[model samples]
Target: MILVTGATGQLGTAVIQHLLRKVPASQIAAFVRDDSKAANLLKQGVAIHVGHYDDTDSLDRAMKGIETVLLIAGTDEENRVHQHQNVVDAARKAGIHRIAYTSRALKDPTTLVNRLMEGHVHTEQYIKASGLSYTLFQNILYMEAIPQFVGGEAVFERGIHLAAGQGRVALALRSEMGEAIANALASPSEGNLTYQLTGRESYSFYDVAASLTKLSGKIVTYTPAEPATFIAQLMGRGLPQLLAQRITGFVTDIANGQEDIISPDLEELLGRKPTPLNEGLTLLYKL
Candidate 1:
């Protein structure tokens, strides 16, 4: 059986949906914190295994007879590394053959996202140390994050305000990332591989603005802000201080052109072009 953790989450749900196309629902298990949250999936015939990253016994029980396990990163801002360790230990005890993990595109310990990604990197190391066949899906920023740029509440009203000066980001659609994960889970390759997944092309903040303007026929503007001022704006707009600071720092990193590069690995894995910026914008506009 293929077990998916965090199955109720966005990425996890997408992964399970893609898996259903290649594997029977009976062969799939969802390890979720809240069983009620996955009632729809259970109704669809997937086995529901109640569990949380903090509960080792739950993880061990859920992992039983599971050949492949996908460990979707938890959303906990603090103590995630330890939480991931719990899942890793349980998987090791269950004797799972292959494991897949979702990690960030670029995880530098010094960056704002480092706290978020440190757990992923640590879990990767733990999986490797456990001697299980493993694959690390290092996914880039999702095109879906564009909505975050617009400020969730005022998105349709004020348009997107980004401080990513001239930096170009290679954004991949979330579904594409899910497809890549499904491919890895279906066919376990020899040795551990870290796939740096990105879109077919890179785009600057201005490019994203232009795409939005063309797709929505709405006047969208990209505004650059200093780190301190950006953080204040986000906080004023109802974002928590911690999250606002992290978002500002990530945008600063992008503005510095730190994540402008692109790779063909995503297309190679899915055998299709990654969704373009305009297409993603148009889809979001409709939503």
Candidate 2:
């Protein structure tokens, strides 16, 4: 059986939906923290396994009879490493042969976003040490984040921001990530393969702004801000100090163009180009 953790979440739900199309419901199990939150998945015939990353016993029980597992990284910034460690340890105890982990696009520890990804790196190291076959899906920024631009939630609000300005970001549709995850689960690849998953093209904040303006017929602008001011603004929005700082660091990295680059890896895996920014914008606008 294929087990998916965090099935109640956006990416997890999408993955489960894609998997249902290719595999029988009985062959799939969704590991959700709350059973009540998974009523729809249960009604769809998916086996509901109640568990949380912090509960090893629950994880062990849920992982029983499972062969392949998708470890969707938890969103909690603090204590995330420990949470993932709990899942990894339980998966090892359960003797699951293959594991796929969701990770960031780049693993460079020096980058600001890498601070957020440190847990992933540690978890990956543990997974490799456990001797289970593994696949790491290093996904790029989601196109869904673009909506935050219109509301000044992200980097576009301030007049200037710090980043590797010339760098590029290869964004991707979250749905395409689902397709890729399904493919990985259905057919486990030989050895440890890390796919730098992304959309078909790369774009700057200016490009993103142009796409948004075209789609919304509104004049949205990109204004970069210094890290301190950016963090202050995020804190003003009620974000915790540490998280706000991390977000500031990530946006700075993006502005510097550290994450800007497109790879055919996603298209090659899914056998089709990922949805572009304009198309994603149109879909979001219509919704």
* Model 2 lDDT tens row, 1-287: 99999999999998999999889999999999899999999999999999798888899999899998899999886788888888888888899888889987763555555366577778788888888889888888888766653353333333223332445678888888988888778885688878888888887777766776776666656565666777787789799998777777777677655567567888987987788878887786562
Worst 10 residues of 1 by lDDT: 107-116
Error of 1 at 101 (Å): 0.2
Query: Which candidate number has the best TM-score?
Result: 1
lDDT string for model 1 (148-187, tens) is 6766536546766776778788998998899888877877
Error of 1 at 98 (Å): 1.0
Question: What TM-score does each of the candidates earn?
Answer: 0.92, 0.90
* lDDT of the structure predicted as candidate 2: 0.79
Question: Model 2: residues >4 Å from true position, as ranges?
Answer: 149-167, 236-240
After the best TM-score superposition of candidate 1, give how far the Cα of residue 179 lies from its true spot, in angstroms: 1.7
RMSD of 1: 2.0
Error of 1 at 164 (Å): 2.1
lDDT of each: 0.81, 0.79
